[model samples]
Target: MRLFHFSEECSIERFVPRVKANRTNMPPVVWAIDEEHEFTFFFPRKCPRIVYTRSEGLTEADNHLFFGLTSCNIVITVETGWYDRIKKVSIYRYELPAESFQLFDETAGYYISTETITPLSVQTLTNPLDLLMARDIEVRFTSNLHPLREAILQSSLTDFGIHQFNQASAQ
Candidate 1:
């Protein structure tokens, strides 16, 4: 399967193993998302979002509560405040060979490699919202993401990703 690394910076030539500022205790590595889960990363790097999909054995009640009337298999919710930034930013998708990566998180489709990697190609996603629409994923904007974030944390919706939740707006 193909793996991808998404970033706002476009001039990246190669990715070197380095410790994430937030997780210095973890070993230095290159991180990439498998194609199956890359859609969640199609936004400004720090935009707070909740991406979820219906998993096996999901109850009808939970489905209706979490997804409502959406027919799309996946839904991404974000705080309304990030909309302007999301529209202004250009996201780059770096396609990397999957040889050296190991599965880090199955649900998140995260893979890690200790070796440095050079991207096979980089794609510029000019319109992130259109990308989501073309993928048939529902994008929901809410004034506050706290309520949904809290509910999803306590939810049976096990297949979910909460990206940069701390950066979300207070209201």
Candidate 2:
């Protein structure tokens, strides 16, 4: 199982365990993504996005509503404002050793380690939007992600991640 950590910073020699904003009550831990859901981080950090897949239990109606005519199994939606940034910014994909990490969220493909560690290797992704296109992942840009967020929250699309909601546009 390959584990990865994505960041905008190029030279991160060491990864220290730090408490995430949402995980404040828990102990500090280093987070990494498994191979399956690595696409979720294929953008600038905090670039509000809604990444989802058509999982087994997804209802046809809900799938039609959310996915529409897209043939891609996965869809990543962000706002128009982040388009330039997505096209220009470089993301560093750090390959981390998985020996010390344990699964944190299976669905989200997140693994957590309580100890600090060094990356096995690092690769820079120059064009994030292009990577999505190359992988046959549909990228949707809108004026705001609120509507999509509301729909997914009430829909049967349980296999989804709405990241950095507060960072999304109001309108």
Candidate 3:
């Protein structure tokens, strides 16, 4: 499988999960197969697309061709048909140690059902109880209801990397 991630930053050796408590802040790092997706850019007005490949993590491949410090063991792949999720959210999350991927699918019930949340306040709430737990929440992102989008915009971090992606080859 050859997946892609487009980003403004040049470095992505370590896949870090969005740690803030929100819809898209859960484990695994986000990546995409398409470049035109709406969420590709962090700063749409000033960002450039830097491309990464799964081959960077593959051995027996030329080191010069690999773009960054990606390792073979940490790349996490999602099951097929989940591609739409990537398009809708702009990118998909890939958790390392792999089993953590299910925490997204299995724990959907715990997410809040509304985006009316104060974007600024979401950053301050430190307790899980403050999020108001649920049991079976299915998330769908509409233009206005994107907390993850707000989170990204609100974040102070400089690296807004969006890796380009394609279906992982069945090697």
lDDT of 2: 0.92
- Ordered by lDDT, highest first, the candidates read 2, 1, 3
lDDT (tens digit, per residue) of candidate 2 on 112-163: 9999999999999898888888989999999989998888988888799989
- State the lDDT of candidate 3 residue by residue for 106-166, as single tens digits: 1111121112111111011122111212211112223321333344345432233322222
| Least well predicted 10-residue stretch by lDDT in candidate 1 | 149-158
**How many clashing residue pairs, candidate 1?**
0
What local lDDT does model 2 show for residue 65? Answer: 91
Task: Give lDDT: candidate 2, residue 150.
Answer: 88
What is the Å distance of residue 129 in model 2 from its true position?
1.3
State which candidate has the highest lDDT. 2
Model 1 deviation from the true structure expressed as Cα RMSD, one decimal place: 1.2
Better of 1 and 3 by lDDT: 1
State the local distance difference test value for candidate 1.
0.92
RMSD of 2: 0.9
